[model samples]
Target: MAAGCQGCRTAQHQFAIAMAFQPIVDVETGLPFAYEALVRGEDGEGAADVIARVTPENRYAFDQQCRVAAIEGAVAAGILDTSARLSINFLPNAVYSPVACIQLTLQTSKATGLPVDRLIFEFTENEQMADTSHVKNIVDSYRKMGFGTAIDDFGAGHAGLGLLAAFQTDYIKLDMELIRGLDTSMPRRMIVEGVLRIAKSLDITVIAEGIETLGEYDVLRGMGVRYMQGYLLARPGFKTLPPIALPGELYAAVA
Candidate 1:
């Protein structure tokens, strides 16, 4: 076993994990664009509860297991029939060998009948990367394998802009703090707008996460954000795909 992946050996004895899915919508289409798989406990506890148990040695196993469970759970939940892709959050550090570690994910995708093309792997911004080149390698390998990559919780973690500069990804989910009170805060709007401009220039799709109100939705929509997620749309469903309910105004606009 690799040095960092020591945890993989004893991971199964430590804890069991599960997935909760939340929808990401396309306001223009008024349909499900993607479903983000969030890690949770087997009994449906919050992600933090399960993640707190991860040690350096076990993180690799934890990361690998999360991927398998997310796919299996989503398949059991009937996500494959929908056009929405499955977006799974991953720890870049847990990836010891990008190509080798991905074999199980590939096998899981085939076993579940989920297309590799429909899989989107997102890295959490909160996890500080020790070796950025490793992350780049992982991203490159995934892309080559026909999976989409994203940066989750953008603007809320260490070296946000620096990470972007290091590698371009398919998507960036704006941090909830940036979306909160966005309807009322001019400065926040401006900051988001600027980020939007940068993303556009780089051809990276931006999804505004943690949207909670019609006002926030409208502001972001008016600002040209095509994708969104959060309570205003749907909450995370335990091993289930929640229905997306777009605001009436958005529905009308799409119509």
Candidate 2:
């Protein structure tokens, strides 16, 4: 970050925060594919309370802080000891020059002994963007730099197909609404299946989030979704990595 941004970050330091990590599971291995770093307050408050600290004037600093915080926090929490990647949510709008802004992140990872390849930057599709090409540029730059990128809350927001049609990412997480009660809803199943076909053709991995029931998990796995994240696996652990376990009934059935 530049001196001006450093000043801004220093001024905004009161945004005292913590990170919570929830693993995204891979069904085939039944291990965490990656852990997503969720922003929380220092006292264990929710993300909203911390996110509200961000303003137009301080957005750049806030975004920069989040990146460094996620990297440092994950490393402090033992992410470097595992093969699973560290996924951090980012605000694309705050990024002026992807390459320039990423210098700090690269430095932080290098200092922390965390491989750059083990980092994933995920952005919510619901986040409004004035320039779609800028976001695509960020993705392309991240890809060239060996960083993974993903679209979070994929189907429930604006520019879903539009963004996919424009640039490709490493992963896209399906919105929970589509995954909710999926087994019994033909429309939901059909939609998810269509997305799977598209994702397959694009060579993009699909991660279904908000899976809370066995029926939902069964239908998704049957539909061939191997990557998933939700309460069914584990919840986010503030400043820690939560353990993940698949439903025992599944193993019993296999037995």
Candidate 3:
């Protein structure tokens, strides 16, 4: 077997934290929307770099810190509110630390007066979750506390379906790769349709990610996608997002 990669635990522990906010728009209405907090290492390094340098023992703590920083920064900047949701990413392992992180996040929310319902915890499909039972328990706990949960990059891998079945996610984000050429590709269209069908059956909201082109947007809208995010909508940056508007025809058709 290949040797296990190590070092990320230490590096992640020492990595500085930064936040990049992306606006989530309602595809039908197109307005200055809720913010999705993106995390980056302030040490001039990416999350992957930090993950590559740390040991597994400390990885969850480091991940929790990054997540807390994102929420704290957003609240401090007055960009987040009780009316608008704040989405923060959480590594699968960090789910086990929900009690601690949730306490901190709740405290931040209390200080900012942002409602617990407006806080969304996002989990990416990139990492394998070792204890899904524990993860589900933690996720349920957060939901009971009025927080929403989402699974990012849905339909990107084998575990995506499992996650959907296991967690009562409030939102399911479609992977950008599956959306890039959706208008022209039957395969991509089929995949998105299938995901939508499942999401609808589960009463979960669907958000199509990486909608950078009109063609992509049009196709997703036709597919009944309700929410969207990407450069075409708004890039991840420090600046506040301007209100977005749908193409006139799109509004007329939906209206």
Candidate 4:
């Protein structure tokens, strides 16, 4: 237990929670680079459904609870059998102290026999962080702890390049809106190509997420994007790892 952490007592008093896992596929191998854990209600409710009930009083508890659930759920789902990493989402604002906040996560990792190097924490940029400096601290602290950090929904967010300039994480997940119909849109392709160059210069790996069509996948692969995720590959599995839905032609093309 984290010493003097008050949120521990209030964790999950009002509800039960679980995790759904969606793999971020590595295009070269057609296997997962990592599986992103999504929070869900026990009966399989979506994230938006579960998040609407969170209040400030329980925010910290909920955040802690989510991390624990993601780890335990992933482990129980046999993540140790694979080479893929596990990615969990965290709220930057609820983290009062990075070291203090991560005690449980470290403990869960130890208990699950999942190495810290195989864990990545992803914080979305869709919501502007109340304190950019604090997030940088979180990223720095996580990196020091041998955990990878990622910025989710990169291009469609508020801070955009400003946040990227603030601190570069291990991975950037391009938003679905930017990847949508990318094959048919020259402007979108140009924007993504520019981003790929920036990521390369910074040594930050780019993961194109929310890809749903063959053309989008083909175009992204051609642009040198390797990691990807979304409905076209596999949907989030409720408490399990779903088999990747690979079309024979698509798999042969990528393989």
Candidate number of the best lDDT = 4
Candidate 4, residues 158-252, lDDT tens digits: the string is 89989999999999999999999999999999999999999999999999999998899989989999899989999999999988866465667
Query: How high is each candidate's TM-score?
Result: 0.93, 0.93, 0.83, 0.94
**lDDT digits (tens) for residues 1-255 of candidate 3:** 011122222223455667767878876676544778776566435556655755576565566576667777777766653255788887766444555445556665787667777788888775677777877887788788888888888878558788777776888889999999899999999989998998899999998888877789889888888789988777776523334445664446556
**Which segments of candidate 2 are over 4 A away from where they belong?**
1-14, 249-255
lDDT of 3: 0.72
What TM-score number comes out for model 4?
0.94
lDDT of each: 0.89, 0.88, 0.72, 0.89
Writing each residue's lDDT as its tens digit, candidate 1 over 1-255 gives: 365444443345456878999999998887889999999999988988998999886777788889889899999999878899999988988888887778778888999899999999999778899999889988988999999999999999997899999998999999999999999999999999999999999999999999998889989989999999999888999989998786885457666
Local accuracy of candidate 2 as per-residue lDDT tens digits, 62-179: 7778888899999999987889999999989888778877878888899999999999999999998779999999999999999999999999888879889999999999999999
Sort by lDDT, best first: what order?
A: 4, 1, 2, 3
Report each candidate's C-alpha RMSD, comma-separated, in the order given: 2.7, 2.5, 5.6, 2.6
Steric clash count of candidate 3: 9
Mind sharing the TM-score for model 3?
0.83
Runs in model 1 lying further than 4 Å from the true structure: 1-13, 249-255
